[model samples]
Target: MHNNLHKTKENTSLTTDSEWAITHNNLTSVYRLMGDLSNALSHLQIALEIRKKVLQANHSIVDVSFNNVGIIYHSKGDHKTARINYQEALEIHRKSLSTVHPRSAETYNNIVFVYDLMSDYSNAVSYYQKTLKIQKKSSLSLIHPDLATTNRNMGCTYAALGDYLTILEFFEKGFNIRKTPLPSAHPDFAKTYKNIGSLFNKKK
Candidate 1:
């Protein structure tokens, strides 16, 4: 995938076509999956630059580029930088769509994760609430993977706050939501199970 995208990128001028930005974005994903975060960030930045040049400042796609770049930074453990990029994406989303947009929810989720990493559990829960509100208000299904993820994350945040019963409720809800769509052997299940197990231990 990386090689194919690299070839496409070489053939297309960044300013001339949006495909060039797409190629870079694809390359960024490929690199991210490979755990080459440095390369992922570089490619993502190129894609962001291309998108900014080709699209309006408030364009949704430009916001997507920013959000994706934030993801790479987040994976790299640069929580502050990730938060900045996420906030930028959120601002763009606010400009481009309604206040309750799913894109805004996604950025809120990203910010929640960063705050979680920063040990700002209060902020994480606040953002998670916003995320859930938007997801529930949007056309997303009740059992959407994103909803499951937010539930699980919120459970973890509650766990950090030593709210064992609340954590269990959230964890159970997330588990129920995910069970239908995600395979039992999925990696996300592993994390959820670990969290539940730890919750039990805490209760003991």
Candidate 2:
């Protein structure tokens, strides 16, 4: 949020910051917060183009470009394109950062989502496991949404693979975690309970 606010502060040199990347990035963040995804995507695409022209393709800045555009594609329901872009970001992160870096975790998480959207459940499960492993290694176990993501995705993957026991195990863990960390009526907790109930109904 601070970045979103301060991004427009022109340089002290009495001139606009003519850096192509920064301007597009600031616009992208602002548009994203405003729910204007089309504008956000457009700005991010411009940012990526400029970064690629100025920096190496595998650099962190280039990786961010890939990630930002990939997210836009995902939000727009173009999972195939999203997967390719996420793969590019994943490769860049693997080559440049340690495996458990938060950036790498983000790439892994995005890839998992793309695979899930494509109905590639096996690959999705594999990526989700890798994502949780990275998050756990980062020692952010209490981060609500991420913790919920790990549990819910792991449960769904197990359910898809016909491992009902593991599905129940993870879903219950997620439910308990959410109930304690979030208000009991939080949507996350409610959704978890609904899923568990549905799963049990099928077994009856």
Candidate 3:
């Protein structure tokens, strides 16, 4: 992917506008998955630039580019920059998509994650609730993976706030969802158990 993307860059005159953005975005994802956030950010920035040039300012693809950049910044622990990028993405998503769209919900979840990392539990809960509202109104099932993730994130936020009862409720909801669909050996399934155990230990 790296070599292909670099070759595409070298032959920029041969690449179409959409092709350039797509290749850069794909490279960004590859780098991000490898935890090379610096390269991920660089590629995403290039994608964003290319998209901004070829696509409208409020294009959905532009929103995705911004969101990808936010994810990289969030993973790098630059919560401020992550929040800014997420807000940018959210604004574009809200303008271009329905309120209950999956992308909007995902952006809200991303914002919630940043708030959680910043130790801003109140804001985290607020954004998590937004994500939940959207997910519930959408076609997603109660046991959908995204729903489970939001529930678990809410659990973590409540745990941080010392609301053990609410934490347990949310965690149990998420755990039940994962347990029904995921194999016992799945990492997510194991994580649910671990989270429950940790919360129980905290209570004790």
Candidate 4:
């Protein structure tokens, strides 16, 4: 698909820069999903450069590119670079979107992950709180997957800080949310139980 999209460029009348940018972005997603981080980053950068040339700096698409790049960096364990890209994405989202918007929440969540990876428990918790606030205001159900994931992540962070009681609280919150929507045999539900058991073992 990537090559086919490029081939369309041969007939300039048949393709626009925006089309090329979208194709590159799609390719980036495909590569990222395949765990080809290098290719994903390359395609994402191409898309970002193209969009920057053709669109406004604060365009939502531009913000998406920045956020996607940040996610790649985060996955690569380059927490500093990831945080920088996330901050840029957050700034753009804040300027163009409501505080309670899902995109903003996503950026907040990304930042939380970065901070967690960096072992900055305080910062991680702070961003997690921001993410929760946005999710709540957006009126997402308690059992929403993102909310459950966030709760789980917060529990892990608390566990890392040796806050056993707090960890249990967040872990139970996540488990309860998952238990209703997820079947008993689902991996997510089982994982939640596993996490709770691990916390107990740690406490012992």
Q: What is the TM-score of each predicted model, taking all chains together?
A: 0.73, 0.74, 0.77, 0.80
Q: Arrange candidates by TM-score, highest first: which order?
A: 4, 3, 2, 1
Backbone clashes in model 3, listed as residue pairs: none
Q: Model 4: per-residue lDDT, tens digit, 170-190? A: 888888888898668888877
lDDT of each: 0.87, 0.79, 0.87, 0.86
Per-residue lDDT of 72-137 in model 3, one digit per residue for the tens?
888888999999999999899878898899988888888987888789999999999999999999
Question: What's model 2's lDDT at 151?
Answer: 82
When sorted by lDDT, best at the front, the candidate numbers are: 1, 3, 4, 2
Q: How accurate is candidate 2 locally (lDDT)?
A: 0.79
Greater-TM-score candidate between 1 and 4:
4
Give stretches of model 2 more than 4 Å off.
Answer: 1-18, 27-42, 142-145, 176-189
lDDT of 2 by residue, 1-204 (tens): 545444444333312233756877888899899998898998888778778777776789889889889999899888998888889898998888888888887888888888877878889888887887887788686656677778887898777777788899989877766676676567776688788897888678
Query: Which stretch of 10 consecutive residues in model 4 shows the poorest summed lDDT?
Result: 8-17
Which residue pairs come into collision in candidate 2? none
Provide the RMSD of all predictions against the true structure, rounded to 1 decimal: 4.9, 5.9, 3.9, 3.4
Question: Lowest summed-lDDT stretch of 10 residues in model 1?
Answer: 8-17
What number of clashing residue pairs does each candidate have, in the order they appear?
Answer: 0, 0, 0, 0
TM-score of 4: 0.80
